[model samples]
Target: MQFHLSFPISPLVPGIQHNQQLMLMGSCFAEEVGAQLTDHRFNTIINPNGILFNPLSITRALTSYLDGKLYTESDLFQHQDIWHSWQHHSRFSGLSKEAVLQQINQSQTTAIKAVEKLDWLIITLGSAHAYTLKENSQIVGNCHKVPASNFDKRLLTVEEIVTSLDNVMHRLFFRNRKVNILYTVSPVRYVRDGVVENNLSKAILLQAVHHLVNKFNRLYYFPAYELVIDDLRDYRFYKEDLVHPNEQAIQYVWEHVTKYCISPDSQELIKEIAEIRKAAAHKPFNPESEKHILFLKRYEDKVRKLMILYPQIDFQPLLLSFIR
Candidate 1:
């Protein structure tokens, strides 16, 4: 008996290969999937500016990268002895203004090079609700624990979201015409905004994504939002907070991503990589046991073989770990 609805996602044509460069931006879901792709030895960069929830903030970050914009003291504000950028996440905040600018610019520098040759750009939009600073009406990517009284919050309209992202898409294509964009609405619910408001925000993002995807030939949509919400409709798939997906649910989504986005040959390679990774992580009952030593030698041989087969991947870490 079928216990859950399984919606088959359409495969992306010319599936992603191991050698191609990819970037994942927007919400925490991007981080989750990007980490998995990196583990499998795919060349990927995730959230160069940090986790951004709203589309406008995401677009602003991407625009900065395309321009290779450098942040200075004027762009930062000191709060409680720490410096923060309205355009960056709290991760970039630090006690020293110079140190903060250095961190932010370093990421920007890396992103400038990555985006130029990027093959796939995966975006996971989390919400349409945005917060803007009242002092300058500038959208803040991360509030950095700033008092709520200092900012005004509002739900972004569909037209506004579409227009902002449309401009970003154009800028991205101009930078790299070969870059293909894959859009997904994050399944993580923003319950703090109220359940209904979260749904409304997601609706706006979904509409905007489709609008842009339909307008552009290189754009595609992955039904991650539908897969989690409608297909696996259960509280069990969620963490205790009932907001983020549990590890099991994340794996389920990862499986779907592999099946739909990755090439068949690469999928087979991923399984081999997974086996090698599992063996590398194994901790036996007896460290000096001959059986364990044999296990390590076997995986060491596998890693060497894989390295020879895919010279692009760096298996040095796994190779060193297998060393006695």
Candidate 2:
């Protein structure tokens, strides 16, 4: 007599939940999403290393992250001003350029340390095209004062992106085995780049990221592109420039991401944090305690640093006047 044996199917494993610490990088759009996560009380780090404006910058930052040499500056001038000048054509001469370069080098150590402890990494691909410097063949963040004759425009291919991402992933995994990756194609459009080339570039990135996610089990793709294009489906969701998504669009994207990735426990935690914030907002201020005085002093110090870094910023004068 032949006997048939019955076998039971294995239970489905639950999807990965998001109580883990998150680090975000890539384009400016990633910053928007990161801000929302922080506001919601998620353990999200925005550009903990620093903002990366091009592929070469990304490579350098990743190298620093692996080598444990990212930069950290209490002064905003050391961090933002130099980069802003380079982007805005405010730095035209050799002296100014050298200063910016030096600042970038100094920050490498702090950037590395910030990324070392991250459990999740989210990268947003903004553009496949970049401008490379003529002398050193390095990619520049923006085409500011660098003469038009001193640069070459190059559009990166799908293969190049995949290779770069693979290298980044390898480095992160080497440093820490448990790091997982999430990639999103930025929904922001390149309004200045001709329509055809712009669309073509975005399409290439979308396809490349999709392929990469499929190839690696630990790497995942969130459909920010679909949410903007298919779900929102309205031009009004964009900013005045018709390039970046408006606040409403960003809010929707953030909500969708947290709903899918965040754990139930984490959501509960966020709710508790929100209640605390609300209660704090309603409470009257008391200045008698030592702890309260110390907290106030620390906040004052932060404001002082901001004033020095951004002298022309309107709030600096306002804050100074208030303190005085």
- Among the numbered candidates, top TM-score falls to 1
Off by more than 4 A, model 2: 1-19, 48-50, 53-56, 69-107, 275-324
Model 1 lDDT tens row, 1-324: 989788668899989999899999999989998999999999999999999999999999999888888888899999999999988889999998899999998998999988889999999999998999999899889899989999999999999988888898888899797999999999999999999999999999998999988999999999989988999989999999999988988999999999999999999999998988888888889989999999889989999999999999888987988999
RMSD of 1: 1.0
Question: What lDDT tens digits, residue by residue, belong to model 2 across residues 21-109?
Answer: 67777777888988867765456667643445444455555665677652323211222334433221223213444564555544544
TM-score of each: 0.98, 0.69
List where candidate 1 sits over 4 angstroms from the true fold: none
Q: Candidate 2, after superposition: displacement of residue 70 in Å?
A: 6.2
